[model samples]
Target: MAYRRLSNQSLVGVLIVLVGVVLLVDTTGLYDTGFLLTYVPSLFVLVGLYALVSSDFRNVGGPLVLVTVASAWQLVALDVVTVGRILRFWPLLIVLVGLSIALGRVRPSVAEVDDDRFDLVAAFGGLDRRATSKTFTGGNVTVAFGGGELDLRDTLVPAPPARVNVVALFGGVDVVVPRDWNVRLDVLPVFGAAEDDRPRREAEHDGVDLVVTGFCAFGGVTVTN
Candidate 1:
């Protein structure tokens, strides 16, 4: 009476199998199912929705925009909307981006020390921050058309689990943590990548467990020791 959650690999495998079956059906002239292709754009919408639910709505702006665009694309494909009509509202994208930036610039949840938490944003520029907090908590990072680096190697996460939420759009963000700590990466990449290049620890240590969760669009997020 219990259902096990599907892993990313398992979900991808299922998707591949479904796609193959559809292709086979179409190739063999079983049925005129070409109409299903019109729903391809909806995949992005689904991804955005999944991200929103997974992150508990803490990260919204980027995913919301992605969902909006994908929905528009799907409408166009379904002949419910036209490309010219969508073009007329192109400036709305800029307004949304501005709002996202403004909303993201906020203080962290807790600030026990001067450097316990931080929020960094880099747009059309670069930001380099080094945290030396003895009890590092958590923070947020945003990079759009720029790059950022958060160095926490000198810090100590006395609190077992510290979370960092990141959003990279057409840019990159690098997080450098201690070599002995464990990293739990839960980032979503859309036409982008989020990589952990840190070497595995041969032995386990009772150190901080960093949780990096966010989404990247046409960009990347890298974690290293």
Candidate 2:
């Protein structure tokens, strides 16, 4: 038999049927212990179907279902699903769902430009820079600029350290360099502080240079090595 897609309304109807089934089973005192475990997969299927059918779903219901399922799974995993606990977490879950839906509406466009060097610019407010052609083997590279963020974390290659230069106008920045690589940071007057929590020196390895500059009207910056 071939699989068939269910509409959002049909999925909701199916969910209602499943809930009725659970209620009937509970009243009969049969397999009561695994009720939630048995229903979670069904609920996930219904939510997935709902997300597929409704174009406006992701902007509204998708996040709500996701947060609800995640919360339920956590509670079931910890074996702590009491009525009071569920009630207490419900409001927080609603807030998370609402926030996710609101944020999803603000979509940002990303573009990659290639030139003489490995230049990656996510210009939200027209900031520009050129990255040097250095071998950045094993390290984490993170660049956040102008309400946009970029992270190249946990590279498995075993090459030399990396160098990064960034400029931000009104956003946040965070980067993590490898412990073995040597690193230097230069920030312009517009750029804010260079916050790093890594140790002064590590074992045998060289760091890289990390320079950041911007007009951070309401921006923050961070870099680590």
Candidate 3:
């Protein structure tokens, strides 16, 4: 069965709300912010729960759980490292993004767009989606302080002409459609770029037409074949 579009923001929002609730609980004088150390591991645990519920979260949640364990190991086994120690491991974020890309590839293949409406939003993180749809018409994608990717490389475009509304601020969105599809870009790029990287052909667009209309502020949108 298909699940709701689980973007990075949605997952991060869950973690944030959890942390806020913990802090809110502590505000009753039961414990201080330091007490959060006791429940730090729960952060990744909750993300893990989302992983089990939504396939879209598995790629991100799995690596987050691993990172949490590593962090906990440093905190407990290494006598509580300082914030600088954690920053040193920031490169792992790139590694996790690589893992997310690889993880997305190994997922079981399915028809991605079974619904008429689809929404994807990424904030404070990155989301990679490779999908197929026989009934896909139009949708919306938003990215802020983050990035998102939509790969429709191998999909059936029942709707030849579809529109995708994109909003990127301090972030970017990358799209991959069929090679033969005609791309109409109408995005306002402010201190940013919106480009089509596909090789051009003079042939007519007998396949599908993807009109990308959006706003990019301090960010960009890329369309590739």
Candidate 4:
């Protein structure tokens, strides 16, 4: 039998369903699951772990920060530590940043890949790329303490919807698509913002549908035509 891995989209849908179920059960007042909310921060730990596994541990900086912040908050929520105590260790972020830089330098660099799909990363730098693939598929973009731009105005997707995951941590990403295309933004912003700045059109065009989804922590992702 062939093994099939779950896509992030499916995983997110499952989580949403589960959350709805939990909320429904809570409304009945038969059992108290309110305490479970305290563990909500742990979701970031899961996200970090997933990112590590999915990227074969190549994408580290942003995920590591997510896990660290979530862990600190979890500890405080559980009454295991106080907010004051955690604040004292906040300087460790500087150390983590240094480690991330060192690890990035040691990692092997990848040459430019096919235009159909890409895995672009901008860590402590800037990245600008344009996609012109006729069979344009979805791809990923990660920005950590840096900026990135993915211009797909000249690209043509064979399919209707292409899913692109963008992660911005202490940085920002700009996605430029064709004016005729429609964008579905489902990104989560934590102390940040994600905006779709495309001009409103009265009639829909027969262009590709782009689904932009991911996390923005202390950063932003802007989609424009």
Candidate 5:
């Protein structure tokens, strides 16, 4: 198989550049320490931009934009808003996810696709959701300094196999797939580990295959049935 560089690799590079710039500014005494954290939310917007341009990841970009802006709002409210009051705004994720799914980013009439692909991201937070695709093709999962739970156990896959690409940096990702399917682990972890929990005997020739491939940097990947 030909090696395909993931489109989100650009997003990862941009994040690294942003972090470097922030450090350089702080080193030059141009900005204080906490200053960098405030602009951290913009990382999502940057990722959203990358996704917006990618044919496969466009559907996920909008939700990332919305979540980033809402998270930034919470940061701005730090002066007058109480912790509880700020926490109340957390429900915006549910609303945004619903809206994104309702107003899908992918077209229903697209060829070779049974359903539109969606993106899931978790940055300094957690995500727990499922896909509505009957013949789920594939999507991306990104976690930066946070945790994410992607439940695809209920997803129908009349298609033979699907890919779920993941990138976890200083975070954790838990992928839940159907019990009867076979999970192929093709991940490379640098200061982390990827565990495939599917039963070897039962899932030997499996109904379908889920290829879990990606890189984990100082993070973890857990696959469960």
Candidate 6:
């Protein structure tokens, strides 16, 4: 059979053996003491090994290795060898390290801004509050909102022919427009709904044309003119 990927347990066992050898040779005085004290070194070895296996070493491995080394130095400095002392604090250490690793895994999207427009895109893995807004020159504008709330409004300049394109996905989008402006809105099926509070009459003044599109998993969109 083809060789399968090694399990975390096997990796941990190898690391434990190596650490035990080093500890035994480096600290011969350990055997003179009771076995209860040996748990401290064992615990540190296990934690260091676990961190190495669980962490994404390629991208974040260097810092994590540094942390493990620092922790080992601290243990040596304090002479933490007693099993009772090790057990008393092991749970707290594990919890703290686990939480830190979890938080470090979170990544955010990149936002780019140019002279004429701003573009933002991100893959928010399940639990993220999407909130953003941008304003630029009212010429061929495009807006997209997905899986969250989007509020877009355009201020009409004294100039004529202001065109906007807006796209929203799966969530709610709200847009505000001038009272007396000629505007056109086209929404795809992906967008939940579109509403206009203003009366359905042609505006006497030249107004801004806003178009929006995007998708959301749960939230809805709202537009006001």
- Which one is best on TM-score? 5
Off by over 4 Å in 6: 1-116, 120-136, 139-154, 200-222
Native-referenced Cα lDDT, model 6: 0.40
Q: Which candidate gets the maximum lDDT versus the true structure?
A: 4
Q: What is the C-alpha lDDT of each candidate?
A: 0.74, 0.44, 0.67, 0.76, 0.67, 0.40
Model 5 TM: 0.55
- Candidate 4 regions with alpha-carbon error over 4 angstroms: 1-6, 27-30, 55-59, 79-85, 101-134, 137-173, 177-225
Candidate 5 lDDT at 110 equals: 25
Q: For residues 1-225, write the lDDT of model 2, one tens digit per residue.
A: 998554333434465587788777877887584647554644554444444233233233443555466557666655677656666666776776677557556733222222222333222221222222233332112222233333333332234333344444356655544454444544453535555556753323454433343323345555554
lDDT of 5 by residue, 87-131 (tens): 676777677677656655454412132354655555544455566
Query: TM-score for each prediction?
Result: 0.50, 0.33, 0.52, 0.52, 0.55, 0.31
lDDT of 6 by residue, 83-199 (tens): 455456555555655655665577342212232332222111111222232334332211222232222333433344433333333334444555554555544444255555567
For candidate 4, give the lDDT: 0.76
Name the 10 consecutive residues with the lowest summed lDDT in model 1: 105-114
Stretches > 4 Å off in candidate 3:
1-114, 201-208
Q: Which parts of model 2 are misplaced by more than 4 Å?
A: 1-118, 121-146, 156-161, 201-218
* Location of the lowest summed lDDT over 10 successive residues in candidate 6: 121-130
Give candidate 2's total backbone clashes.
7
Q: After superposition, how far is residue 30 of candidate 2 from its true place, in Å?
A: 88
Estimate, for each residue in 106-212, the C-alpha lDDT of model 1 and write its tens digit: 62321222477765554444556677888889887766666768888878877768898888888899988987778888899999999888886423555448989
lDDT digits (tens) for residues 4-99 of candidate 3: 776554455576587787778678766677656565765554544544344355345344545555555547534577666776877776776677
Answer with 4 or 6, whichever has the higher TM-score: 4
lDDT-best of 4 and 6: 4
